[model samples]
Target: MSAFEHSSYPEVAKLTIPDVSVAALDMGCLPPVLKRFVEDGAMRMQAPVDFIVVAALCSVGAAIGTSIRVQPKAMDTRYQIVPTLWGAIIGDPSSMKSPSISFALNPIQSLEGEMRIGHKNAELEYKANKKIFDMKLKQVEA
Candidate 1:
């Protein structure tokens, strides 16, 4: 008889799958400053610390951009890891996930506002320079 035959296997009255267990977040794993921020935000918003921590990590990863990379193995320089990170805070409706994420990303949002202003100023300067160059070219041609 082939082992693949259904009769070869023992029949069970019932099959049970154990529940998945998730470990709790360890605040010590985070830097002191970040830990404090997460703790404060969670307390004030009455949200889970995990949400803030994940948001903070994602924000940092985005802020770093593509300029930085990590080498998993020092001996193998061929492989490089980007700082890109994606995170989602899963919670039922009325949960404080939105507020927690907003709190964590506040600093990043502020920086983005400043960067936008700088970019607008640079764009205006470029337009002014281009107009001056065009006038100079017209004068030289005539």
Candidate 2:
């Protein structure tokens, strides 16, 4: 009986294993704004943080456009940051992919709507003031 002793029972079929590796998500790499969105989205949807964070970052970056730029000390040139990015939230139909994205974009959408309303009100006020000034000018000329 050596160190590799075998049982007296019948031999069983050997199982073959596949070579596979899984990569993990690194939340620390995310910026503060995106990290917060990821946590909030995960809590609301009861889903993993990885997908939510990616989706949120993409949405925010696209909305921001080229407002911000990235410059590296090691690099000779400055990189004009067009933060627009495309991401995929892959899951089955039952997964709350759309809902999570919508949740992330809700704040931005609401702000845009409010800005549009404010612009309309300002235009109306400007037109009204111009009309009053024009009427006064005609009366004085008469």
Candidate whose TM-score is highest: 1
Per-residue lDDT tens digits of candidate 1, residues 14-129?
Answer: 86766989899999999999999999999988999999999999998899999998999989999998867999998889788889889999999999999999999999999999
How close is every model to the real structure, measured as TM-score? 0.78, 0.65
The residue pairs in collision within model 1 are none
Note the clash tally of each candidate.
0, 0
- The number of clashing residue pairs in model 1 is 0
Tens-place lDDT digits, model 2, residues 14-95: 9886698868888889888778778878897887776677677777777777887666545756654444588888777867
Model 2 ranges with Cα > 4 A deviation: 1-22, 69-81, 136-142
- Model 2 scores a C-alpha lDDT of 0.79
User: What local distance difference test score does each model get?
Assistant: 0.93, 0.79
